[model samples]
Target: MTLALHRHGPDGVPLVLLHGFPLDARMWDDVVAELPGLPVVTVDAPGFGASPRPDDVARAVGRSAEPALETYADAVAAALHEAGVDRAVVAGLSMGGYAVLALAERHRGLLAGVGLLDTKATADDDAARANRLTVAAAAESAGAAAVAPMLTQVLGATTQAERPEVVERMRSWLAAAPPVGIAWAQRAMAARPDRLFTLEDLAVPALVLRGAEDGSAPQEAASTMSAALTDAEVVVVPRAGHMSAVEAPGPVAAALRGLYERCAQGSVG
Candidate 1:
């Protein structure tokens, strides 16, 4: 798939980051800046941002017509391989969080640990699946402008005046996303396997984080996963929402730095 990537940091244990749905790697700009001396890679998922959307959904999904998250995970692992990163810490936001868990499942040896930010390891409920389809239909019908308001509301409530910039960023990202890509993501998420078992199934270090204000992921999910994981940590970034990388980059970066260092040092018990 060859997703477009933005690289930062130095030649240390590589850290791969996947941005949330409807957003590209730009969402991690601030967080990436916080990792000063480690090799960092941020990728745009296929069909979003600068990456090309797959023309063959059936092929990607394997007869179900649903897009596969593994396909995107494969693309990410391929990108890391192309850059000579055999193993590293993997982190993701929202849909990217799904990618991280899939990566862990498919290539546990290739990951030092995982950071799941504002993302759940569970599969989508029926209501969530229905909502995604509904939104996808609307995105196809109304284009980027129609979804901008909801994007703003879902991200977080800044001051009334601060709303404009948030909406503008979302508008730009959505406008740039191909409609096919949006639809494909919706189907992919709907069909994704529940990865809560990934925590117990593998001993890889993990950190689950969410915004204090994030209604999407909620604190209960993080607590549940953290309690279940053999070596998992939970963090709540105050005053942040779904987009903590943007809303509170400092804590997110700090969390990444600590997670990476622990993984690098073999500190996870």
Candidate 2:
């Protein structure tokens, strides 16, 4: 199934924003607002936001032993083609980052640059994989609401303590997420391949960003990824967490603007 695409701006190297698991295109609302006239495309990966669910997605891509991340990358590539964008600077947060890496691996020619935000290149460890599977089972059996407790772990301490509105907004998104989508994402993430080699071989300009307080993708992970990329800039947003784009839109937008300009100037691969 064709994923839903939210288009913005025009006439430049396209900036494709991919949101993290259980969230949708709306997660980029504030950052997009800050970007103003820069060309941007935010996508709802399969089973999230306005896009088709996992069953439809599985059918659309046909049966395969490939991980779902590759399927997601293909959907994004198709969406861009339909939008008349031949190449784009792809940026993603968390699960979105995994998809971006997958895109780089399978559809390298379509990328102009990459933004890895609050994510890592390492595959899940055994314990982490088991935990993800457990979460998937819980989400399947009890619905999306069963994953609400993740808010505490995903957000920064400051966001949890002071940003009631942000917390509520995130909660709403998580609560409304499809159970099937959550389960599918968890399983896919658990099974994701380690892509550190992809980063090491990257030819395009890349940005590695993370919230200073991000537990999911720590500062060390950002540094490691930055070290791997041939050309990369690292940005750590203070007072933020896993959802740095939401927690610190100003810094995230500024960083994105820099990446966009680099891509537009033909400096990026």
Candidate 3:
């Protein structure tokens, strides 16, 4: 479990961030900059960024191999432990959100707070699962280009039409994703189990964020997650899509900063 971890700030329980599929810790650069003095830690998912693929034993460093978010969560916990952090306000967006739940389910003691952004707590439906597997297979053969079509579904209409830079930026990230990582992440996500119950017992402050224009993770999903969380605040970023943090860093960062402060005060469960 040698997931790459990048820590920021000098002390305090850092806000640990997980990136969405096909992207790396760099996705949070804008949002992290907006965070000012807050402590932060960003880790690349297995097979993404500087981390090794689950099956890339030559670089796996340690632990078993599987296309499971539990594996990703374990790697995350291990990375943080190595960094001397026993607890943190962990947050994730899209695919990253899936791992966040896995962490909550498996390493509940490590969480100071939980943030779910542009993601759902349910397992992929039959069609969704099939599509993911198909894409994974295609990506393995065609490389990152196989996921390029997802660019349309990732950014909001407003962003695609107005923020050409952001769309192009997302395109580059998608294009730069490792083919093996892309395929592995798709399969892992497809095989995930329903995790709504995990949040029901989280007993930590939660933030459910969605993009007002997000087509992938709609308002319904956000509501379902908020409903499951005992202490949750739902925030919708306007003119943003599935990549809300990148599309609207100010709002996303503000929401995260609030969650961080709550966890820091140790005022909430």
lDDT of 2 at 61: 62
| lDDT of candidate 3 over 77-138, digit per residue (tens) | 88888788898899999999999999999999999999999999999999999999998999
What's model 3's overall lDDT?
Answer: 0.89
Spell out the clash pairs found in candidate 1: none
Query: Each candidate: what lDDT?
Result: 0.78, 0.87, 0.89
| lDDT value for model 2 | 0.87
Highest-scoring model, lDDT: 3
TM-score of 2: 0.95
What value does the lDDT take at residue 143 in candidate 3? Answer: 94
Q: List where candidate 1 sits over 4 angstroms from the true fold.
A: 56-65, 158-167, 267-269
Query: Looking at candidate 3, what is the lDDT of residue 185?
Result: 89
Model 2: pairs clashing at backbone N, Cα or C within 3 Å:
none
